[model samples]
Target chain A: MSGSDASATTLGEASERETLKRIFPRLPESRSTIVGPGDDAAVLAAPDGRYVVTTDMMVHGPDFRWAWSAPYDLGWKAAATNLSDVAAMGAVPTALVVAIAAPASTPVSDLEELADGLRDGCAALAPGCGVVGGDLSVSDTFTIAVTAFGDLEGRAPVLRSGARVGDVVAVSGMLGAAATGLRLLFSEAVDAAGEPDRARFERVLAAHPETVTAQLRPRPPIADGPLAAQAGATAMLDLSDGLALDARRVAEASGVGIDLDPGLLGDDVEIALTGGEDHGLFAAFPAGAGLPGGFRAIGVVVPGAGVLVGGRPFDERGGWDPYIGWDGHGG
Target chain B: MSGSDASATTLGEASERETLKRIFPRLPESRSTIVGPGDDAAVLAAPDGRYVVTTDMMVHGPDFRWAWSAPYDLGWKAAATNLSDVAAMGAVPTALVVAIAAPASTPVSDLEELADGLRDGCAALAPGCGVVGGDLSVSDTFTIAVTAFGDLEGRAPVLRSGARVGDVVAVSGMLGAAATGLRLLFSEAVDAAGEPDRARFERVLAAHPETVTAQLRPRPPIADGPLAAQAGATAMLDLSDGLALDARRVAEASGVGIDLDPGLLGDDVEIALTGGEDHGLFAAFPAGAGLPGGFRAIGVVVPGAGVLVGGRPFDERGGWDPYIGWDGHGG
Candidate 1:
């Protein structure tokens, strides 16, 4: 493909404009963004009239290894990770800033491919939100940092706190795909060991295509966050940590108890409870309110002190913990 | 000092609370910011408007090193570096998002100290801005990336291509203190090769205290950028690359020549001509207009190519250049 072509042959085939086209339609409208994307600096209305912002860093070797992912995939994943934080707060994403550090020997084509992926990632979730400003520095290793902005749109922001007894619990995206994909990519089981051999790795990839994609490129449920807020979501958060752990955060924050139904989780119990990097919306709503579109009913708020799964304490064997590295049941 | 009490220090002090306080003043009065700095996510005014944004990264050992400065100094310098880019395009800085990556063994106090310095740096310039969100990740070394946002106040942004011949050149803020200070810091003439020579360094430090401070903490003339716009600056840019090199950018952008008067620079010849990191405003105004306050006549526009200093070609000498290492002068 030519340099400017929009083909998907090699990762470099896509251009920034092509990526933007794919992602822009998904974002909701917001008034605070006077000039959304495509500029030196984005102009926000700050109508409430203030702006809330934050940033996060992802380094290649420390954060992710190239052996398991491509540069474009890395770019998309990085953007999604930061944007998910913005979406978690019941806010509308407005703009994103990116800083990339890479070895000078890195191919310019790879850089362009990364930009294409970033444009696609942002547009897919926040439409019309382009990287407005950035700094490119040379380093020995590849590192990316993204700063994200959001607008509250005149509604009270739903925080980790505010979950209460009798509240219905819901989630707006899939679970465990990322963790499963990661295991397939990193585990020795896929390398030279295990009963099934290398062919099993291909079987895993074929069986869970969506899960593999989820690990490569997370799509933050940007629109559902605001919709949930409009539907009176009492408490909300992005499920970056496993559902069980993140739910514990909400329970602790609101000073309440959470009881999750393992039966409701279906056959993928481990994925539902301990899978992370879902970028899915997990929220608590008033009992009578209808669950918004795209959300699955998962559990209920209760008057207790901690998180429970199937009427038992959800321990590490059945949950996710960043420190211990997400070894749960069935994995 | 106690945390809350120390929070009162300016954002330049690099403390957590001060980061919030500095941003509080600049935020537009809006109800959307329900849970601002102290929360996991800040509520904002996203009222049907789109948002624009960008991000940049600075890595220690590559972008900077501790042997050259303190943690707080690094904090201040990092914030200033990104803020300059936002202000360069005639935008009002609003919010900042930061991500820091460091070794697991890195001291938490050092991180706090860095935060204090970042707070102080932002407060010194771009007051009323606050750090809204961030993520801390472990890496082999220290790195900081910042994403900054600005409001355009609904005007078409002034770009680099608006200059015309016969326009006069003006500058706001100092010229070369940073470059000079850097020279003093790394030279064997100022200190013995391996001895802990505080006294020797102090003499060098005292001789050009402003320059040393400028290198450690750059204060971009952000207010003057808008003033230049209002004063009808034909073309403008922040002096990041050395003046001569930066002049070439404006010249290439506008297709005009910049003729500088070295004799006009007062008492700091080396800094006036080749120094970098001044973060001063360099603008082109129509000839015969009285220059604005805080601005001084340094050059004039002509109808030709590139830049000239004292009727000769202006050789590029100072500024941060990637190829020649941090302290080397590049031609």
Candidate 2:
């Protein structure tokens, strides 16, 4: 994305200090930031005495593609995904620290757009949260690692191992949409490179803006984390590794089997069950306990092992692992 | 670096879960880690009510060369560099979260050795602090981003902006040795690819194991951070960007000029001024506040601007900036 100012400088033409000066004002400021960027270390007040911390990294090739996303969307997706991890623990995200490693040839304008997206993402979804610190370096490829800190507000962290046998399995927000969107993006990329499927692909891309956004920059139900905690969620996690893999994780951790109902999940049950990158919340509520608004019950916990479908293990597998990149081919 | 085990598997041959499982047992376990690696997010207890946070990343080509470093050294360096940041804040580090992005061609056993380095580094330096969580992904260039958390134990952080004009500036440990070692490594890399300079190069390399270690895997004086704070250091920071540049930072932050003494630092004063990556403690103490062990007085703060030697700015410069890799060339 180009700026309105003519003759924008690329990051290659600037000094390290100059690059930092240009990006400083673009980051959102947070109230919890007692000592923001430009210090030996940042001091943030943890009023509740305890905080939750999680970190994730996105690489250029394995995590995303420039053809599929703009610098802004990349920044937004990075922030949103890390935010979802914190919210999964029943906490309010307070601060973010990002480390960006990019090739020197990258345009400085792109970094500015990335900064704007980071600020905008927090403002639109997790307000009051801001980027507190950053470290930049040169690398052969671009990679962003983000660590998010959140306040639990005296509540116990909702762990993945807290589910009981009688808990009702549910999900919050969109599911499988990101995976579907990813498939279309891959198809579009292939189409652009080879034979033209422009008309059909255009209809697919133009008709599903939400799906495109989901695959590119997902806005998970951040608020539902606290609501689930308040409603006594027995177990909780973000559906990043697809429902099947992540459900099995919670089950193994909590020592219970997840009995998923394909019929109850409506028509997109296949995607909901196996598609990853949804960034939606996966939680368990006691059998009779009330679920927060926007939550849909899709399964239940039973005394057994692994994730189940139709009261038995599925013959088909659903999930995306990084070893196999976007093409489902080994790296 | 390849492992001693001949049958070691490359990461391309393993799944993400399998890769993680192979490395999990090698990480050191921390008592503060209520939940360790393997979950969606590891849960850590912040018993002191507040924590000090800092992050740093090391890229392969720009930060270090595999020719000069082993996988063990790479892991150790990554952990040491970040631990130094937490200690710079006068906080004892408690936990570490690392996200590693590497190519598929990297060996799984190399990662295991990397994990061993991580655990050993923490055990040898910041005892009781251990690796808590990790996020693994595929990338073209291998990068390790480490975020370290520390407990302040109720003392207000000693910021870089707290130095007074009358304060005495002191530093702990060696300076410039790492830079000198880096030059040697570069020459060696160039020599290996070009004409031979074997005799002299071998002598230069073999004569300075400490310097080589400083460049490839530095174990800085981490304990000096709290010792400085206990000695009533008013302003503090670690020397990563050379003495001149970093001194200017503290000077600008505290609004005070610094007058350094070349003679006071003894014979290695030139290296002391321009050499960085020493990871030594640079602290400003109220004049005659009784300096701690190993910390030598090197300069004094004065009312002016920037850094000065003999009341004049030095003609030489030494430092590392990402935009310009080792040669300080932008892009």
Candidate 3:
């Protein structure tokens, strides 16, 4: 069938031969790819002699819901999630491979929409880094797993083990927006009725439109990571967990103490310290190093143990623990 | 708890955090990795460079069955499946990250065993490689997804489009063993209540124990891929979708025809033509180039179209098609 004329409904039922004929030509070819999709595996070139890799999985229920997320959003989220990992490493994302599992009954239109979303996300976050290859399988529920790769270009990999005493702690991008967005989505403010809670969801829309969008679709600070690394940042990481817990991690990894400046947090101290899912970058700079663009100094590393928020010992009373759920007030 | 005193029952959950701690001591000091695992997103070292990457997924029901496969086997298979792709590109396997989804009730011991399996698989298949990172989530069924990275060592990648009409088709490792082994495992003879079917299963098992193991745990010829590239193989690929289909892929990509000599099958035409899950290296060599070690001449490139078996056209009827099921045949 012609590319534009091919219907999504027929993509799965058509034999593997036909699928190959239709899909193979649409993919782009690059000199860095020795082998592209269609083989058992695609072969890629790692010019830097070292490669950085990461993976993430999005399940239909736990990670996303179809009623709330469009197929394109699902695709975009899948790519964005893994890209955040690669970006968090201060690496430049070069390519991605995705494995998608959905029910046989899933409309082909949905799949195409998902692909479109993936293309959009990659284009926005990582130019020239497209979906190089992927596998499609039939499953009872929809699942999307994406893997991303980056090149260090012969520079030493900025590992989590490099923080030292006297380092300056800093962050880039907004924190807690995604977390608050999620809270708004799940709260009683959104009713679970017509169109899968659109009415109640509207309340969330009315309350914090930007935060809700952030929660629904996180846009990782892809460039800020590398920028921080280049700016003499001594230690760096992505803020996925709450600030306090993640700060503790940096302290432990760097074998130093972390003291956060509560005065700097303004009104969102609780959300800033306890929030999760903000794909922002946090780095520890050498003493006296100026912060880079999009970054703000937030704390300092000292010769002690654990993390202290606003000079007070931080506890697990706030933030998120997978088993304990959210610990912030009203959460 | 002491390493020796660690209880197997608590191995999965209790040790996960501890293992992260243990790895801290072995990590290299890098400024790019500002934050590590304890945080939501890891800070990584991204030097100023481009990146190359790929991803794959393994579902419980479609890829492996726990009834006959152990947790360790599943882990090894998952890692191997992704690593093969990295290797196929003439790249040295570097780091890997995994995302797993499984039932909450899954035994802790099973999860630990799976982790051990991943470690063993990476060590054996791609030395110096580490699991590096991962995510764990609860799901109704088991799913494993791995993303792998590789270093190209400055060599130009061997693309599928470089094959010439006179190229020789060569392969490394055995074919059809996995497919045949799977057949024996799923047949009525193996799980049937009757004596006759049981006898048939026993006969097949006795005759092809290696085949059964091959299906259960495929060992991809990872090293051969790079070797073939270094040896100047015009085009190369990994054999996963059966010989005929995969060979056709090479032909289509190179814009040439391939002719297989059935007589060269050496008494296992069924396995050579219709086998799946071999994960072997298939390369097209210059007409006069010597076959690399571990590779055998199986076919030749011709000046026509598609793949021909014994001078005759081959169809998908004899091979594995996930949509059509196994159909109780050679595939």
Candidate that beats the other on DockQ, 2 or 3, i.e. the better one: 2
The estimated TM-scores of all candidates read: 0.80, 0.94, 0.84
A best-first ranking of the candidates according to their TM-score comes to 2, 3, 1
List model 3 lDDT by residue over A142-185, tens digit each. 77887776655555556555788888888877777888887777
RMSD for each of the candidates: 7.3, 3.3, 5.4
- The reply for model 3, stretches above 4 Å from the true place, is A1-48, A153-156, A164-166, A189-199, A317-331, B1-53, B152-154, B189-207, B323-331
Whole-model Cα lDDT of every candidate shown, in order? 0.67, 0.82, 0.68
Error of 2 at B178 (Å): 0.8
What is the lDDT for A172 in model 2?
A: 93
Candidates' chain B TM-scores in the order shown: 0.79, 0.91, 0.82
Tens digits of per-residue lDDT, candidate 2, A1-331, equal: 3545523765666677888888889988876887778887888878877777899999987787675678898889989999899899988888889999987877877888899889988988789899988899888678999998888887888999999988999999788889889777666644544432435545666878878779887898888988888889989999997888889889999999999998876578788788899899999999999999668898999998899987988645578778864332211
lDDT of 1 by residue, B90-178 (tens): 66565666777665445455666787787888778877555666666655546788776555555455566778999988888778767
* Best of the two (1, 2) by lDDT: 2
Find the candidate with the highest TM-score and give its number: 2
User: Evaluated on chain B only, what is the TM-score of candidate 2?
Assistant: 0.91
Shift of residue B283 alpha carbon in model 3, Å:
2.1
- CA error at residue B300 for candidate 2, angstroms: 0.8
How would you encode candidate 2's per-residue C-alpha lDDT over B113-145 as one tens digit per residue? Answer: 889899998888788889888798888788999
